[model samples]
Target: MASKQHRLTGTQSAIYLIISITLNALGNGITVSLNLGSALWTASAVNLSHLVGGDLKLLLMLIGFIAIIVNMILLGGIQWRRAINNLVFMIPFSILVGYSATMFNQWHLDNLPLVLRIVLDLFGIVMIATAVSIYQRVNILLHPLDDFMQIIRFKFFKGNAPIAMWVSFIPPVTMSLIAIFISHRIYAINIGTIFSLLFQGSLVGWADRHVFKTLKHQGLDKLMTAKHQ
Candidate 1:
C-alpha cells in the first residue's frame, strides 16, 4: 500500500499538475524561441516535426502516446485505468506546448542576438528543471517519458536517480543522431540539447533538494498534507 503521507488529494494533485504542465509549456516556448534546440525528448520531436512537416504539438502527443504504450508493454500488461489517467494530463500538456510554441513563434525572438538567445535558453532550462522537480513531488499522473524513466530506474538501476536520468537520455540522443544523419545537418540537436544532456540532471537534482525544500518550508507541503488527510 502507498503511504498516506505521500499521497495527495484530488484537488491538490490537480493544482500541481496544472502548475507543472504550465511551466513545461513555458519552457518549450522559450526553447523554440531560442532556435537552439530543446531538451532531449523535445529535440527528438522537433526533428520528427521537421521530417514529417507536422506540427510539433501533434508529434509530441503521438510520441507521448507511444511512450505510454511502450511502458505498458515493458511492464508486462496493459492497465487501461492508469493509461487513461496519464492521458488526462498528457492531452492538456500537448495542447499547452503547442499553444506556447505558437505564441513564441509570433514573438519573433529568433531575430535576437546570440547572447540574448543563450540567456533565454538557459532560463528555459531552469524552468523545465524546476517543473520536473515539482512534478515529482506532486506524485500524481506524470508525463509518459518521466513515468517511463521512473519505472526503468527502480526496476533496473535500484532507484538511482542520477543514473536513471542519464540512461533516459540515450533514446532521444539516438533519435537526434539519426535525424542529423538523415538531414546531413543539425536541426534540433544543438548546443541546448548538449547542455541539457550534460547539466539538466544536476540542475534538477539541486532544485529538488533546495528549491523544493524551500517550498516545503513555506508550508506548501504541509497544505498538501492537510488536504490529503
Candidate 2:
C-alpha cells in the first residue's frame, strides 16, 4: 500500500510538472510584454514620492513583499521547494547583496563610465547564472513564478524542463534590459542593482545546498517517507 501511494505521489508530481510547464510559457509571454510598463510605472511612483522622508528599510521590505505577492498572483501558487530554499537562503543573501548595492549607491560612483557599469552588470549576470545552475541541480520547489511557468510548460510542451527553465528566467532578464535602457534621477539602471539579483539566486542556491541538502543527506527524506506511511 505504501509503495502504491508513493507511486501515486510521483504520478501527481509528474502531472503537476507538465501543467506547470505549459502555463509558464503562456504566462511568461504575457509577463514579458506587460512587465516593462509595470517597471516604468513602479519606478515613476517611487520617484514621485522622493520628497517624502520615510524608513528606507520599510519601503524596501514592502517592495520585497509586493514582489512576492506579484509572483504569487502571476504564477498562481508558490513552489514548495523554491519557497523553502528561498526562506533558508534569501535572508542572508539579501543582506549581503542589498548592503553592497547600498554601498555602491552611496559611493557617488555614477559618474564612472557606462562601460564600467555594464561590466558590473555582467558580473551580476554571472552571479545569477551561478545561482540558477546550483538551484537547478537541487531539484527543489520552484518559486511561485517558476512553479506557474512550470505548470504552463507541462500543459503545453508536455513537461519540458528546459523550456520551463528558460521561461522562468525571462522576467529578471527583461528587468535587467529595461533597467539598462531607462534612467531617471531617482532610479537608473546600474550594475549594482542587477548584480543584486545574483544575491537572490545565490540565497536560493544556498538553501538548496545547505538546509534541504542537509535534510536529505541526514536521511530525513526516508524518515518523512516512513512517517507518511
Candidate 3:
C-alpha cells in the first residue's frame, strides 16, 4: 500500500512538472527574443546621449567581458560537479543573440511610437521567460548568473532556493530601474524590464524543482547522459 501511494504521488508530481516545463519553455522563447530587442534599444538610447567617448564603449565592452568571465568562474566554483558537457550550448546561443541584436540595431527604431516600443519589449519578456524554462529542462550547467545566485543563497540561507534567487536578481533590476530614470525617462512604468526578469527567474526555479523532477523520474536524464558526458 505504501509503495502504491508513493507511485501515485510521483505520478502527480510528474504531471505538474510537465506542465511547468511547458509553460516555462514558452516563457523562455519570448524572453530571449526580447533580450535581443532590448540590447538594441539600450544601445540606441546610449547613442542618444551626445556625449561621445570612444574609450567609454571600449570600457563597457571590457566590463561586459569581465562580467561574463567572472560569472563563469563563480559557476564553476559552486556547481562544479553538477556541471555537465551540454553547457557549451551557451556559447552558440550567445552568438545567436548577438547576431539578432545586430540585425535589430540596423532597423531604424527611433521613429517607432511608444506603443510599439512597449510591444517589442513585451515580446522580449516572453522570450526571456521561455529561455528560463528551457534552462530548467536542460539542467546542463546553471548559467553563471544562476550559479552566482545559488552561491549567495547558500551563504546566507544555506538551503533556501527562493531567497538565493531573489538576491541574485535584485541588483540587476535595481540597476535597470536606475537606468530607466537616467536614460529612458519613462515615468509611471512599474513593470519595465525588471518584471520579465523576475518572472523568468521565478519560473526557472519552479520548473527546475517540478519539471526537472518529472524528467528524472521518467528516466529522460538517461537519454542525455552520453551527451552530457
Which number leads on TM-score? 1
Local distance difference test, each candidate: 0.72, 0.39, 0.43
Where does model 2 exceed 4 Å of error?
1-84, 102-111, 140-186, 189-229
Tens digits of per-residue lDDT for model 3 on 1-229? Answer: 0011122245554454344434433433333333333322233323333223235345344434444455445434332234432234334444555565555555644346767756666655554444444443333433445434544544445435456666666654454456565655542233334554445456445645554354322222222222211
Which regions of candidate 1 are displaced past 4 Å?
1-6, 49-58, 214-229
Task: Rank by lDDT, highest first.
Answer: 1, 3, 2
Two-way TM-score contest, 2 vs 3, winner: 3
* Clash count for each candidate, listed in order shown: 0, 20, 17
What TM-score does candidate 3 reach?
Answer: 0.46
Q: Report lDDT (Cα) of residue 197, candidate 1.
A: 85
Residue 163, candidate 3: Cα error in Å is: 4.1
Per-residue lDDT over 45-129 for candidate 1, one digit per residue giving the tens place of the 0 to 100 score: 7876786678987888888898888767656667665567678867777678778988998988888888898888888988887
Tens digits of per-residue lDDT, candidate 2, 13-75, equal 444433433332332222222222212222323443343444544544454454555544444
Clashing pairs in 1: none
Judged by lDDT, which candidate is best? 1
Structural RMSD, model 3: 9.2
RMSD of 2: 12.7
